[model samples]
Target: MQAHAVIDHITGWLKDYHATAHSKGFVVGVSGGVDSAVVSILAARTGLPTLLLEMPIRQKEDQRERALAHIEDLKQRFPNVKAISVDLTPSFNTFAETVEVDESEYPAKQLALANARSRLRMMTLYYYGQLNGFLVTGTGNKVEDFGVGFFTKYGDGGVDISPIGDLLKTQVYELAAELEVIESIQKAQPTDGLWDTDRTDEQQMGATYPELEWAMSVHGWNRPEDFEGRQREVLEIYTRLNQAMQHKINPIPVCEIPLKLLNGS
Candidate 1:
């Protein structure tokens, strides 16, 4: 795990991709978490103009402070990095008040509002990307992106390409250390930051990142043929999480040809 090599690889990827796409720069939404911080630095290292937005919609002060601090540090290090702070709380409030929904559908209303926050952030990032001829970069790691589908579909999940999507949660931490990301962000708990439920990632996922990474590395969507007690329990937890997030993990359903089509009806 040579951190320097990993950094070079990711930076090179961004540079090449930007040149190939003929984009002016990159747009990244920083959440002050390890994953986003790493992505922001990687994008900045490309030497292309990069826009970092701290879009906080009713975000906790701790989260917003960390994000701002990270942006300030990264800007000092990278001349091409530009930072902006946008408060979306007012916009969110307007939307929440305007939209009519039945509170009886508890889960529906809660999740919808949460996802709306993410979508609003996503839209803001794209607006900057398009206006400045830059590509939007996503900050999802492998454990969250594929294993558990921890991101909102077409929200944070929407991007031109994922640089670290191949790396697991543990691996992202490794990269964070290698990239010299701010200590506060590196040590901060991971969160989607879409809601003020005050719940951490582990609380919501029902498993810590280390445990999830282990499950992904060991079982990986496959049933454990022989395991006992805690081992089996972990496997079961992985199965349940994978199943629950199948909609996000596998969003598009396959379509098959009908018999009528085969017969040239």
Candidate 2:
């Protein structure tokens, strides 16, 4: 299906969900990125009372400014929508100080810290939702959520509704184009904005998005193709991530015995 059609279908789903649940509206996190921008637009277009939260922590001034700009634009587009900004630096720092680790574990520790920030933002969303009668909207796309398990288990992954989980990263950009998001965000590289450093999602994935998308589209999702070099690499990464985070995706397994009789009956 075309990207626009996909957006329309998802928006329709959101509308139906709202009608069925009798919800007050939807809440979305605006990360100053294309995925969130598209999600915010869809939520607003559905005529829901959308809330956009920009949670920044130790990020560059430009990053926060861009996020605020996107939120402002969303406000203008959807007059009924409300936008708010919250600085999460204090909470993030407290969490970081509490987690003890060795100096050798740099990136891993940093990743855990970043995931904490994401989870904190999610918590904030739910707190506000409970107070205002809204459902939290997830901004993760299929490429990030499924391809490499690229989200914190209970952090950014936690949400009441996911509108873009079925679309690939490339398709997300297409939807952003259809939604007329800011040109900068529409063309910008995807990042987690976890630290002061400039880190691209593709860099962490160790492969270009087209390459990863093609692999996942073909072999991972069974899109018909010969499994070869790059395809093999993609499969390796996918398998590793899948196995590594299997526990996170599934409920805890408990041993069950069929027909256990109490009191030796």
Candidate 3:
């Protein structure tokens, strides 16, 4: 489908979801990244009161400044969307201290930490949503969520609604461009910003989004019969992520056990 149609489809979907749920509005976390930027714009255009949250950790001066600036810019364009900033460093540090596992045992500790930040931000959103009446809007795209299972299960993955869950990374960028998000963020490297200085999402995933996106379109995860070597490797990664994060995609497992015997035998 074309990018314009995709954006309209997602916007309509979100509007329908809100109407059915009787939500007062929408809440979106803005990470100074393209995905969230596009989502914020989409939410605002839906005519629902949207909230853009900036939850920063012990980020560098430059990073924090940029994040705040992005929030301010959104505030100007989206008067109905309230932009707020909250520092989450103390909470994350406390959570880290409470966990017993060493960093080596979990090479992805940084990712875990980042997930904690995401989750905390979600919790904050929920609290505000409760008081103000709004549903939490997820910023995850299909590429990040499906290709590498990059989201933190209950953390970033927890949401009342996901407007861009089905769009690939490339598609998301295209939509962002159409939405006219700031050039810097639209062209910035994608990162979860979990640690002081961390590798980009592509770096950690071991494959760039463009390459993985192509493989996904061609193979569709389960791996076709013709793939070989590196192609097979990429397929495996994608399949593992899809399978591993299946729980996040579907929170409840389906049970098919019989409640009672046909004749009470």
Candidate 4:
């Protein structure tokens, strides 16, 4: 998909955007995933400083190693790239203990904990970005960001700019190949890297990225007369995701007078 041209376009966009905003460069959270890797490279190509931060909270060893490996690779390729590692396990443990309610009765706190991890990472990125006058570059692709709402509201979604948000999942791979992303990260299962259990994105989304893309591309969300079983399933999954994430998609709720107060007001 003309990877070089696409990369050049994104890099140029970053350069212009940074200058217009009077910012120094980009600050990216490198999770050793393909999306982040590609975004980091694009940021590096701008000839501006790029800070790659690895904030792992109860992270798996392999994930941590891959993250460091990718950071080193970026440093070698981009002279302006500097990396910093901060393990958030201790902080997360403290917060979890401080807020853990009865799991037997209030059993949904684990999900909140996962979301907290993302928010913590966001706080770090924003702090560094603001300190150095850099923008926090988000790694979410199109299907995840728009189609499926596969990001925490103020967590992974909390970024100053999103370079790859327009690209589809398959398009990201094409760009990744051109950018020479780490082989392991490119091949690794796609995960949000949020949960303590290491759950993949497919598991959390109830469908693969490609499947979600297909649903998004379908004819106006219409169920055709003839459809394969999995195709229909994708439609259902996509619809359900959209229904459940309306709050995230449309975050600011309108304030209206209640029915009882409307007449008096």
Q: What clash count goes with each model?
A: 0, 0, 0, 0
- Candidate 2: how large is its RMSD? 2.7
Q: For model 4, how does the per-residue alpha-carbon lDDT over 1-265 read when each residue is reduced to its tens digit?
A: 8989999999999999999999988999999788998999999989899999999998988888889999999899889999999888999899899987997887878888889999999999999998999999999999888887888999999999999999999899999999999999889998888887979989888899888888889836486334778888888888788777767767687898798897785
Deviation of model 3 at 37, angstroms: 0.6
lDDT of 2: 0.82
Q: Which is the leading candidate under lDDT?
A: 4
TM-score of 1: 0.92
What TM-score fits each model?
0.92, 0.89, 0.86, 0.93
Greater-lDDT candidate between 2 and 4: 4
- Candidate 1 deviant stretches above 4 angstroms: 220-225, 254-265
Candidate 3 residue runs with Cα over 4 Å from true position: 60-62, 100-111, 220-225, 228-232, 254-265
Model 2's number of clashes is 0
Per-residue lDDT for 19 in model 2? 86
Q: Report the candidate with higher lDDT, 1 versus 4.
A: 4
List pairs with backbone clashes in candidate 2. Answer: none
lDDT of 3 by residue, 9-110 (tens): 888988899999999999888787788888888998788898877888776665566567777877788778787787888887888889848878889777
Backbone clash pairs in model 3 (N, Cα, C under 3 Å; residues 3+ apart or in different chains), count:
0
- lDDT rank, highest first? 4, 1, 2, 3
What is the C-alpha lDDT profile of model 2 across 115-202, one tens digit per residue?
8888899899898888889999999988777776778878888999889998888888888888899987877788888766888887
